[model samples]
Target: MDNPTAGIDRAAPVVARHELTIRAPATAVWGLLTDVPAWPSWQPDIVSARARTPLTPGATFHWRTAALDIASTVYAMEAPRLILWGGPAQGIVAVHQWTLTSSGPAATLVTTEESWDGAPVRADAANIRQALDDSLAQWLGHLKTAAEKPR
Candidate 1:
């Protein structure tokens, strides 16, 4: 079980990073993130989301994405802070973490981190990683726009 994320620096991993500083508070950003119905309005990749349990540490969720028709459980959740989860791809599991922090003056820094576990059977691990990375970038950009929009 080698570290899939090893040899990659914070500046950039083998997979790309999608980051944005939202001009809204963490709470506001979290609201947009956790809102199931609104996700499809902004996040083109996420087809749907439903809470299997209240947003507790061990609470669960069903996340469906258009990219892979994948549904993953919510492994971790903390409002105005973090959401972590993963889904299986050809027996290889992929994990992702979304973290939000207050930057200042009603601003929040949002970061998405992703990693894969197990060898990829497709032998296109790099391409797959890049696709995931690009998707995250699109997602984050959409979030930034949505968060900044007047409500």
Candidate 2:
């Protein structure tokens, strides 16, 4: 799944935010988010992924897509609440969060927020912004479909 062809946006620092609501419980979403190995099934952008070590602070993981190669290290992991991490320098530093709230008797509101802080592939802020915006949108769409699926 190594995306040797994946374009890297190395312009100025860019920030992207993507959010989605899931009908599933926070716990369900948490399970999927924390389990790095399961990402390929739902996250279409990531063709394959695996953690080089367990998912703990400082543990590294490698993920691949048709257009990108992502290497990340877990910064924080608090089940049913938050999971944050970033990638190697020149790579996207991402904070992936899952917030679950009780809606009523048999339902939960699962909200996911993904943000990235990094340099753009070029100097044009507009172009970088466009890429970030598009990337986040695609990511959120993939996450929404995956998180909403039956476990």
Candidate 3:
């Protein structure tokens, strides 16, 4: 990792974390993950994504998922290794991070974690946690399929 990972809010009422080993190089997985506009193609949970501004620190991107429109700002980014982004949506504040570690010649140990805090999340912590867990799992599965695709 070129840069240290930025963590999610520890005090957040709801948190979800998931990790998976993908049979693809870190660079390959990072490529697919960072390409926001192409997210809907691989990550079915996302309805759309657009980043008119380059994905540097403080740059914001808008996307829709699970019927919620989210506008997330790129908080930190370390190419092929880590990225942290989040924002407020539907009265909930979310902080999400993705970390990719090269495990072998063509493998990556990828981890995704998110923290949520706000009235809605606190009101239904159990359901929100489960939903975030399911969403992250599906995201990892889809990334694995996309990155492992024959080039």
Q: Compared to the true structure, candidate 2 yields what TM-score?
A: 0.71
Model 3 per-residue lDDT tens digits across residues 20-99: 99999999999998889999998888999999977888899999998999999888899989999988999998999999
lDDT of 1 by residue, 1-151 (tens): 2332232223222345677899998998889877765688888778876775555544446666754555555666777798776556556566667899899968999998776545562466677777777888888899999999997
Model 2: runs farther than 4 Å from truth?
1-12, 89-122
Q: Lowest summed-lDDT stretch of 10 residues in model 2?
A: 1-10
State the weakest 10-residue window (summed lDDT) of model 1.
Answer: 4-13
Q: Model 3: residues >4 Å from true position, as ranges?
A: 1-5
Give the alpha carbon lDDT tens digit for every residue of 1-151 in model 2: 1221122222325555555566666776667777888888888778899986668776888888646787876666666666666554354455544455655533455544444444543355567667767866776677657767775
User: Estimated TM-score per prediction?
Assistant: 0.78, 0.71, 0.95
User: Which candidate achieves the best lDDT against the true structure?
Assistant: 3
TM-score, candidate 3, is 0.95
Clashing pairs in 3: none
What is the alpha-carbon RMSD of candidate 3 to the true structure?
A: 3.4
Superposed by TM-score, candidate 1 places the C-alpha of residue 26 at a distance from the truth, in angstroms, of: 0.7
Residue 136 in candidate 2 has what lDDT? Answer: 67
User: Which is the winner by TM-score between candidate 2 and candidate 3?
Assistant: 3
lDDT per prediction? Answer: 0.70, 0.61, 0.90
